[model samples]
Target: MHKKFMYICFMSNSKLYKGSLTTIILKLLNENDKMYGYEITQKVKALTKGQLKITEGALYPALHKLEAEGLLSVEVKKVDNRLRKYYKITENGEKETTNKLDELAEYIKTMQALVNPKLA
Candidate 1:
């Protein structure tokens, strides 16, 4: 029963995680100073212990949207004869990161209450 519950939670996580992608990216940039697209993907996987994977299809669009919103600034540099774009959280982004993280925390608390009221 415990293993089955764990499996179910992990499966649900994939769909739930998509909604928090923007916040996840912002939080990572806030901590790392700057990161490239692929680096961000790898970091999420590592941090989640291989449970979570961020695909390029989802990541690039979120990065573009955040850049467009002025929450992120990008710098392109040549590395190993290839151009790589690094994303850094802007001043606005730093502020937004705090807001988003707080919001996510509250959401998690609410979810806990709903899913397992005894835990709350």
Candidate 2:
């Protein structure tokens, strides 16, 4: 079935994003002004068409690390009687996003050359 194929493909591809997770978060935050943890997860899922899922265990630590690194800032507010934390990219984060994106682009090119040398 198509669903089973997609599931298998997604499972294999999931590990590809591990090194780029922070860059992914930074790029997403750069595109959007601010996002809560769950919002970021949903956005990634929607954008990837369910191929990639960001787990809470992985997501929270990255957010915390970015915050500590001075690249992202957080705000807390109450919504629907529940407190929610929102993350916003700092000015430095925008710069880092650009840098990471450039690096990723180059990495992709290198991978392409190696993976499909005829195309390269």
Candidate 3:
């Protein structure tokens, strides 16, 4: 029963993270030196206790967009005879991560005030 409840909660969290996916990715990469696509997805799920999973379809596109915007730089390295692309945050990406985090924080504060006004 507890596992079932956790599964339901995880589904809801997945929906919420979709909109904030890029911000989450930027923050994660900021903390780590570099990460591959699959590594990023696994880290997010692990950190969120399986509540959040970044789909590959969603992740690759966001990485490409950030790279195009100069917010990220990618390096390709061969491991086990296969090439893997690792992403690292750029100087601009660090600055953008700060701004994005501040924006999200403000939004959360506004949401708290509105969702539970008595606590505000």
Candidate 4:
């Protein structure tokens, strides 16, 4: 019973975080200029009160895809005998972030209307 409950919670939380992954990454980079993988993950967890957790598998692919699309740029740095890749939003990324945020806000408003028609 406990395992099943845990699984359900995990799935629900994953859904929420997955939808906001791009927004989260963009906002983080916008605030900090750049961040490494672990830093980004930790920041999201902390800021969201552990509600939003980013897995390595999900994060790396998203970061790589963003880099490939020229929305983000990366810098590799040596830290404590290991190389860490830090990501920063490019100019295109900054503009894209604004657009995405606007679209997301509109989506939320639409969802709210569907959920509670009187509120719309």
Candidate whose TM-score is highest: 2
Note the residue pairs that clash in candidate 1: none
- Please tell me which model should have the higher lDDT, number 1 or number 4: 1
lDDT, candidate 1, 1-120, per-residue tens: 356444322322446775788989999999999999989888988898888878777889999999999999999999999889999999999999999999999999999999999999
Better of 2 and 3 by TM-score: 2
Q: Single out the weakest 10-residue window by summed lDDT for candidate 2.
A: 4-13
RMSD in Å for candidate 1, one decimal?
7.7
Task: Supply candidate 1's per-residue lDDT for 107.
Answer: 98
**lDDT of model number 2:** 0.88
Cand. 4 TM to true fold: 0.85
Compared with the true structure, the alpha-carbon lDDT of candidate 3 equals 0.84
In order, candidate lDDTs are 0.88, 0.88, 0.84, 0.81
Q: Which regions of candidate 2 are displaced past 4 Å?
A: 1-13
TM-score of each: 0.86, 0.87, 0.86, 0.85
Candidate 4: pairs in clash: none
lDDT of 3 by residue, 1-120 (tens): 356445332323335554697899899999998999889878888897886766666788999999999999999999999889999999999999999999899988899999999888
Badly placed stretches (over 4 Å) of model 3 are 1-14
